[model samples]
Target: MKRAWKVSELARAEIRHGCSSNPRSLTHFLFTLKKSANHGSVRDLNVDADTHSSSSSSFDSSALFSNISRLFTAKSPTTLSETLTEDLAQEVAQLRDALARNLHDSDEVVRVLEENCGPLLRRFAGGSAIVHLLKQLDSRPSLALEGINELISVRWLLGSSFSFYQPKDFNYACKVLNWRRKQEDCEFPMTEEEYAKGIALAGKVEKVGLAIELFSEAANKQLRTTSTYNALMTAYMFNGYAHKCESLFWALKRDPNCSPTIATYNILILVFGRLLLLDHMKLTFKEIENLNLSPNLSTYNALITGYIRAWMWDDMERTFQLMKEGPAKPSTSTYLLMLRGFAHSGNLEKMEQMYELVKDYMTQKHNPLIRTMICAYCKSSGKERIKKIEELMRHIPEEDYRPWLNVLLIRVYAEEDWIEAMEKSIDEAFERKTTVQAIGVMRSITTTYFRSKAVDRLATFIKRAESAGWRICRSLYHCKMILYASEKRLEEMESVLNEMENSNLSQSKRTLWILYKSYLSCGQRNRAAQVIGLMCKHGYEIPMTVLPS
Candidate 1:
């Protein structure tokens, strides 16, 4: 007890001395002083040096000295210093115990860190940022947050982004109603404002993973619907996680609370189609049926498109046969695809037969699309198709310029040349209003031009397309690029390549190809090699043939 009093007095004296040199020291001194007041629990025998003394002789000697001192003892006053010393000792002990307990990882620790970046973050920043981003990319209207609560009416709806987050135009009434009911106490899950803002943020950002996480978290905490799931599933699929997409389908099936709708299977089948996993895709058709779900045209269309692109003719024919025989009806797209593929393959007879079938199925109102297909067929067949072309032209709806443009094909086919297709395509394009048919019809014409020798018309269309539509891009543009280069109009080729540079569309392989060819034709080996580096920087895998020599 005497030693503790001395220690406190010394510390105070040192603090007073250092206060002139450092003001912080005085503050620290005051903190220690406040702790010293509580000394009720201080131990009287506790002293510094004799804390572990155990010898009996030493203890007896100390007791004799203590008795001798008491005979002539000088009484010392108890001081505040002793109290502070006792309080400081207790505080240090408590601190050490607390440090030990904190070493374990626990939920509280995780929770504390996550609270900032977790639900609160989504609530504060996610909605507006997301909606803004989506509006920029797709130009689609943003969903109002208040309108989204209607999606959360069911338990499974909880994990979806759309339930808590949504497009801007969704009904505000249902949202307010649901929002009002969502509270634990207030009967609403989140305030209508929070819901709106979170969804808006979610829609705007490109970080789909974060969006999914935020949506999933919100969904788990409340009710969710299948529509909510579909939205998230779409986000996943768009990001190219095909495996995740497939799993989502089965997830719907396995969950007692969730059932896979036709849309769900359609999404799964589309993934398989994209992968060219014919066996897996074919199974999805049966799987949907076995699950007592009726397959929609979208489901059949995905399979048909997949087979057509893969050139799985046997599978295509079988699926088409089945579609024709069953409740499913083939749309114009079905016939158009068959026509397009067969035309590309130079199977003129099969092309003619497909065109005739389209004529039989399409009424006068729906026949323009079929006429577009038949015009494509006539372009491919050349002179033999002239008669068919004339008959199909008579059926073309008013203001459709397809036949006028295809006159080039009439010429080439009359001479049994493929180049006429391109001329016909470009010429006819001038007469038609901009529509989906215009592009396809143009492609059919140009592709035939490539098959023939219509270089002049091909270049014109390429130039026109490049000038239009935020710069013409797509597979067709690349095809046109190749065709122009192959014809060896070096000056015109470079012009098109330069136009591509300014366009929104970028496929580095195409860029590299044009760059390499330009350099090779100009005999600029040094420039060509540098372009090789540039291509690699843009993630273009240089072809093995063009690697060096």
Candidate 2:
């Protein structure tokens, strides 16, 4: 027996209130009516029939019909016209169903929309109905692209904004490139610029697989131009596929149709430099000169970076000098590299010289550099360099309140016995809620105090950090215990464990291991056995290697 369809009470109540104002109800009602048109009886219109009919509500037929009659009579034209009347509603339903099935026939949708929908309807179409349709086809990007582009075209025909939707924004360009490769009779070929941009996006997102696919698609389509080749090579280099980049570079060089540009050689230099292949890196630079291509600022930076990484200091200096004499002068980045190189090599005087030159150009973006310079000064013996650190600290804006920088400053001040300065920095960080990322930063400060054996100070800092609402991690608590154990202050170590217990912290195997090691080191075999017993109680596996012979 064929199941007879009737209007669901939910649909009835919706229509009674004003089905024209509700799209779901309207679509449901229209779909129901269309289904009934093919049958003699409208038995039940359980709109979400697929979800099940038992959950649907029932309403008084007479009351619903009374309200619906008034609604239609009062505003028949206004309601029906605005809400996609019967004919247009059928078209939308068919299109949505077809799109859901991965059908790419946009002509019917576009035609129906262009003929029936006005500017207002077209504007709302993309965000409303089209979005729902697109959701069904997200895994199929080519279909999604077609749907979006066709709707965008409809909007253009209706005298709407032409540039409202950019296909590039969705990162679906790679899918389009792949799709184009399979099409034998190309209606419209993708340009080189589009392929280049798609490859660049792939690289930016660190998607090496997509980058390779896009490149191969372009290559198979015979659309491998210089721009596309360069983009692909860069993607490989930046994503740590240096060997692949090298192979691509050689291929580009041999390709009679395309020649390597200055940009291409720069990529090769960077690849070779990062791999610490200085001979190849230098050879690539020589090739750049041989080709009469002027080395850009990026080229020089890559070469210097390579030299620094390889610790070829003398050669790095000579290259910098040659760069200074050449057309490519040092940029802010170049000076930063020099400063960092000097800092690492303990050449404090030269580091200061480069700092002065670059400091004026340094913005908030260069905070990492400031931290590096401060660390370098702290490592040196001269107390006078403390003033240099102070000057650098002033450059960091108060509003930024970078937690990492605050913790670093605390370590510096604590090391110098400037207790007041260290406390002030800590208070500022806590009050500003900057210490929320406390684990890593707290470890840095704790490590500084532990290394100096400043037990009192370490305890005080830990107390302050906890009181300020920072979660005192197990590791931080372990640091304090280790410090006390090292001093052979067993009572204080026990007190720390009690504090942890009061805080509802549980002990782990590492905790037992630390206790066992500490007791054994202090020549207390009895205490080590107690730790092993506690491990057993906690259901932790006891390692026999820690047992006394």
Candidate 3:
């Protein structure tokens, strides 16, 4: 009879063979040892006819077990708890080394952690490796801040639920570690590049308050360079904090180490223009001149835009003349601004003249200028000009044409009383799912039909819009109510008002006033009082002047 081999002997033989194939397979061998210790069993072995066969097999199994034991003793822990701690330490060290190499290379750090180290750390170190890596980076302040930033961005991309560390914590760690150079030796604790990058990152994420905090920190450290100030100003501009931008601009002027660049002036001019502060725009322009700084194309564009917004045409024209004589030539934007101004003022002659000057330079096939000209022609009832505009628009690709242009064309066709053409345009816009344009066209068509007293046509168009999945806005209902009042159809007007309420569309103050007036005209005094009450319920206070005497 051949004695059965123990399960421990079989496991030892399997681990020996595995280790022989790969001498460095320490972890694999250790796992097999653990399995054998946990579930030991015996298996019968067939004895060979040769007398020496059983003895040889038993000797080989014993030697294999001895080798495995020696290998484990050399490297691995004796107990399960010790094994886990040892594995975790190895994993944390590996992660720490990988991150250290990628300290300055943020992109590489992200790639390595996500690809290689992340799984290992999660399995062995339970995600605490990330905290350890951050602390290691924190030890070296030069790379600490940037490393933390990259890790945070990576964690966000990875959708990690673990809260490791934050940029603010890194800042605190730097102070606590005394990582910053001695104040007597270094003028500023953080370098200009560090400050700029930190502030810009905050700005990129639209965290204006955080950006301001970073700027304040740099300022407190006496690191207010021109670039630092500009960065803070840019953050303010992006956040639409115009007043903050102005305050920083003046503060920059007071700083002996910093002087306002032309870019700085350009930003200030833009803010002033947007606010329609023509006086401030002009003063900033004069400051540029007084400083002997040449005004660029942007500077002139700012002045023109400010004048146009304020409706100071005379000043706008004077600035245009000055721009013509200056070294900085007007750009396409400058031409567009002038064209828009002319369009708004109903100066077709100047609009034509401006178009002729820039026609060759208008490289964009579907330019805003074309849209502006088309709108102007529609406003002026220029039927002949429509054909010319259409011909020009033909050069633009179909996709390049803005949806509003289609709405404008619909309005023009409606004004011309070409009902078939207007309906065709509406159908085409709806087919294309040009939602915004479709809504505008629907509103315009409804208004036109009401004005023409074509109630039947208006009802058909509303049905068409609804079938096409457009939410008819409150303005449309208001138009319908006004039309009903005009026709002395009190029942229809009440029905429209009830529909509006069911749609959860609140009546505007103007709508309420119109309803009140209509009720008074119909000699329904009680209903008129009810209208006033509805207005108040909707948060509109009734003025004494509007109340009945």
Candidate 4:
């Protein structure tokens, strides 16, 4: 009692024509063929020999003849079997089977088509569809070029450019598009807006070279604007290209069309600060005054930061005083810079004074001023001051405490030989996962232990740091080598040196110098000579005293 179904003649005719005209339509034709083959009327075509013969005898000859006549009419006077040649019929059968197996496997279908009918699939399928398929497959760039060309042909310039994620792919697409434009006598000129967007994108991705090139292009085409120049200058400054940044600054200044703004001078001052060019920074500030341009709070902050970096406490205080007198009020950053300077110089009294002065003006909840006070107290040698600092630390919220501040505590305890307190501070630092500060504290503690000849404590602490998962960095290794050299443990020092060489980390000039001195102290003359050679090879100028006579 199976139900019987059939494909209508019109439907059959449409499938036939679609299949012959477009190979991509073969899949649809195969679906229809599957439905037709399932009908009871066509079951005899796939029956056993006994059922086939019996069914063939009772088969509806009239319907079969009508189908044959219709196929001939549709296919220009050819018989059905003749029109679908034996080879074509066999291929269709295989395709139907493959299609049925790969119904849900798009990748398998793509692979089959690519391997067996690549050219035919490309010819019949639309470019967008092929592009989508290729993207799904993550195919090579060459294969994607066809779709890129299609998009360019239809003037989808942005779409074509953005479809590629790889730099080379995007560049290739652009190059092809530009070539096409040239052939068509059309210019592919980027407008100011487009150039700006490209530069912004390049900057966002940290491709400084690309941003610089885009800026250069804009300049060559006279499309450079103030925003573009500022963006390029910012990129230069951030990438540590001070020479190029200064050159561009002067170039922009000479360009009468694009005038510099307050932000421009601020950036220049920041560049000088970063390079520690205090004199140039002062000159730039003087020029600002000469131009009658009023200096803002940021301008003063930059000057104060520069002076702080140079450790010029006198100049920093003078600038800070001038800032208070000027129209611009002191910001939290200005206060923090003063506190840090005082802490660095171990001036606890001045640090306390600045903290009291700026405590009211601190707008943010996370003030670095408190941390600076802790550092100053830790650096001081007075027990009463340390006691006071401990009381102050209790008042601050636990959540606001930074791990580096614990390093200062460790230093203080190490100086006093307070082994229990130092151990507790180290445990707390470990819990905070302050890798950088922990390394710093380790170096400081190692130096202190070396001076005190507390060799056992030093070794135990190093083992503890390793257990805490802190990888010994180059500086820490240098400290170890120095300690070992002082103890005349030449073999241990050599082992440390070997560890440093095996590590991927590059040693700084100072680290190399320390290693050289350690080898010389051990009386390993040949090894010391090799250390000097390495220093010279890495462009570290060797001092004459370090060089053997």
lDDT to native, each model: 0.45, 0.57, 0.56, 0.53
Best by lDDT: 2
Model with the higher lDDT, candidate 1 or 2: 2
Error at 147, model 3, angstroms: 12
Tens-place lDDT digits, model 3, residues 1-549: 012224323433343223212222122111000111222211111011111212111112221121122122111112223334666667657765775676566577557555754364334321233333333343343443354443444443222433433454333223211222222242213333345444544453345665666677667866555545656775675567889999999997887655675656766886686677888888999998897776766567667766765668888888888888878776555665676567556688898887776565454422444665666777785558667667667655666645566767787777666677777777777878765435565567766776677765665666666667665787677777777788788788878777777667876898788799888888889999989888878888888976767
Model 4's lDDT to the true fold?
A: 0.53
What ranking of all candidate models by TM-score puts the best one first? 2, 3, 4, 1
Per-residue lDDT of candidate 1, residues 428-462 (tens digit): 54445332244444455456656665667656666
Q: lDDT, candidate 3, residue 496?
A: 77
lDDT ranking from best candidate downward: 2, 3, 4, 1
Q: What C-alpha lDDT, on a 0 to 100 scale, does residue 119 get in candidate 4?
A: 40
lDDT of 2 by residue, 453-524 (tens): 778788887787777777577777788888889999988987887878877788778888889888888889
Off by over 4 Å in 4: 1-205, 213-223, 357-372, 387-407, 414-420, 426-549
Candidate 4 matches the true fold with a TM-score of 0.43
Candidate 1 differs from the real structure by a C-alpha RMSD in angstroms, to one decimal, of 34.0
| Poorest stretch of ten by lDDT in candidate 2 | 26-35
